[model samples]
Structures are given as structure tokens and as C-alpha cells.
Target: MLKKLGQFTLSILVVSLYSNITSFANNKPLTEAEFKATKLPYSVMAYSNKYAHEYGLDASKAIKLPKGLEAIKLTLSKSFSKGYGPYASKWDYNCTAELYVDKSLNLYWPGDHAKVDKVDDRGLQKSQISTAQLEKKGKYWVPGPYASMLYDAYDKTVKADLASVKLSFFGCGYIPSRYTAAKDGLAIWLEKKGGYNYAVIGQGEREISSKDFYVFKLPQNLVNSYLPYARMAAN
Candidate 1:
């Protein structure tokens, strides 16, 4: 899988640096046989070693961040949320991204038909955000290429009955002051199958044991430094 990904990225590099290549999605999905015949375009966000050490998340350096980016906001599936379900990855879906802040639903437009919760004015008047989360409507975003690619791949390759997801993030980190250690990831309810399976690759990667969210104890300084690479890659 890594070899294939490398080839795809090289193809993408050629297109990005030289000419315009169109349409990653094709009538017939990519096949190994066809791919072997010719390299195709694919770009991935690469993170730096210095940046990886800064985050203190030595999971997979292969998950590259866009270049020169500080940090990118992202919306993830429930599979990775705290209190995860049967099909979620205990690893990627971690406490670092959960909406854990205690927030009271104060109000919502559209009568909250989707069960959208609004924070009570009294709740969390203002705080500092250290982690990333998903954005609802009226939210602007500038994610890196991989986020879109992952979403597309999930929609195409994964057979599980995943729900319609419309999430966006900003390439430059935002100034929102809400806690996300509880609300994001799969634990908050998204997939009907109630589980998440990685699309491909990442075999034998190490994962922390599922305990309380935030078990990794990511410090603010580390996050701040590493976030840039994540932003650039995901932007």
C-alpha cells in the first residue's frame, strides 16, 4: 500500500509541478493492474520529523501535513470519538479531538430539527481551543487535499452504510474557544453501523489503549508547534 501511495504521489507531483491532470475519480475505480501499467496522479500531505516530535504523536509520520501550514481544522467520523463503538479505530479516533467540554444547549435556528445543540450563553463564556472539531453550516473551511481524498475514498470504497457527512475545516487554525474533547469523533453518533474501518494501509501501527479520552496527554505547546504541519497537509 505504501509503495502504491508513493507512486500515486509522484504522479500527482508531476501534474502539480508541470501540467494539469484532471479527474481522480474515473468511470472505473483505480485497479492495481491499470496502475502498474502507468503511474497516476495522487498527492499526500507530508509531515516533517521536527513537527512530529513537536506534536508528541508518534503514530504515523506517513500521514503528512501540507507544507508551511501551522494547523488545519477537521471534522472526523464518530468512530474515533471517545466512548467509541464496535467499528471505530481506538487509535485515530482519540480524545485529542473529542467535544469534551461541558456545554449546555442554549438555542438553535431551524428549531434544532437535526438535534443540533446550541451552547447556553452562560456556558463557557469564552475559553481557549486547543484541539480541532467539525463545523456546522455557515462555517468556512480550507482543508488540505487528503481530507477530501479520504472522504471520497470512504464514499467509494467502504461498503458500510455510512451516513451523509458534510464537514469542513479551515487551513489556518481558528479562534473559536469551545472544548472539543467530547463532541467530535465517532462516539457522538454519526454512522448507523456504529463502527469505523480504515480505508487501507496503516498495518501494524501502534495505538494507545482506550482509556479516558486525552490519555495521550498532549500538551498545548506540542500541539501548537505540530499543528502547522497538520494544517498545511490538510489544508
Candidate 2:
């Protein structure tokens, strides 16, 4: 009789402990409200380094980046490479160029050429950024050749208090050549200050095949709030 009673007591204690643990887990949130308050700036590194880092390699190469901007590189899918250019190589996979204005910016991996999605409140919209408008410079395409197209589109499309903006270039797939080709790249513009705090120019969709110009805008207050945390992470 005593043995049975002790067993019942132990079972009751186990059930009580489990209930408390479950309650604690259910109440906890993924991230604290303070952490969500701000956005961080992202870093820029060479394509080779970023690729090597992803595969657990010791990447030591450093690529010079423009002022107030960081570099981003992406690799193309095997199937995409095989279909686009017969001479495509493993190195050719690292064709896309990425630049981040904020060093603490979050890292995102949206296969090949993904499209940007629409968001609310922060004043983000899709602009008509076509490859046809970009200028061909030697082997690569440059936005400097077609600044007017972007400015005109901004004036016609963006309805907000404009303050400051920056533009960068991105390549989608590998093209067979001594250097990156003009047609293989696209232009991206980001708005640093204005009605919105964070804005980016890239593809409108997040799919691997989509490649076009897109503008993303966010609130300045939201980004500023997270600056401290972002700085810590960068260091």
C-alpha cells in the first residue's frame, strides 16, 4: 500500500513540474520588444569571401567598397548557370553584387535574383527599373550612365519628403567574359533619409529568377532605435 502511495506522489510532482515548464515556454516571446525597435547596418565583403564563409572556408580577401556603402555577392544556381552560359564556372556563380548602406543591416538569402515584396506604413513601392535603361561600361553595366532614368522615376513615382539617396549595382547571373558584363548587372538605389528611414532598390519579387529594380523604404525612427545593438553586433 505504501509503495503505491509513493508512486502516486512522484507522478503528481512530475505533472506539476511539466505544467510549469510549459507555461514558461508559452509566455516567452521570440524577441524582446527592445530588440525589435531598431534595424542594424549590414557589412560588405568580396564575393569570394562571402562564398567561402558560407561554406566554412577561411576567406581573407578584402575588396574595396565605395564610401557609405558595403559590398554583397551572390552565386547563381547550378541549373541557371548551365542554361545561361556554357562557359560558366563555379566562380561564375558569384556574379551578383550587393551593397549595404547600413553595416548592421540584416543578412538575407533570397536565391539568385529574388523580388521585393510590398510592405505597409514605411512608404515602400516598386519602381520601373529596367536593364534596358542601364549604360554599358566596358564589360559591366553602370548606373552612372543612366542616373536620369532613376531620378525621373523617383519624381514621378515616389510621393514623399526626399532627403538623401544612394544607388548601387547588382549582377544577376554569370556571363562568359574576362570581367563582369553590363547586361549581367542591374542598378539598385537606397534612400537613407526622408519620409522613410530604410529603403532599398532591387528586384520586386523574392524569387530566384526575378531580376529588376526595386525600392524599399522604412521608418527612420525604427532604424535609429536599434543602432546601438547593430553597432555592437558589427564590432
Q: What value does the lDDT take at residue 198 in candidate 2?
A: 19
Task: After the best TM-score superposition of candidate 1, give how far the Cα of residue 47 lies from its true spot, in angstroms.
Answer: 25
- What is candidate 2's lDDT per residue for 1-235, written digit by digit as tens? 3222111111000111111111121212223453343222221123223323443433453333333322332111112334355564332211222233333322222221222322122234322222333455565443322221111111111112111122221222111111323333233334322222113455433321112222322111211222223222222
lDDT of 1: 0.23
Clashes found in each candidate (C-alpha, N, C closer than 3 A): 36, 24
Residue 124 displacement (Å), model 2: 6.7
Best by lDDT: 2
Model 2 TM-score is: 0.23
Worst 10 residues of 2 by lDDT: 6-15
Highest TM-score among the candidates is held by which one? 2
TM-score of 1: 0.18
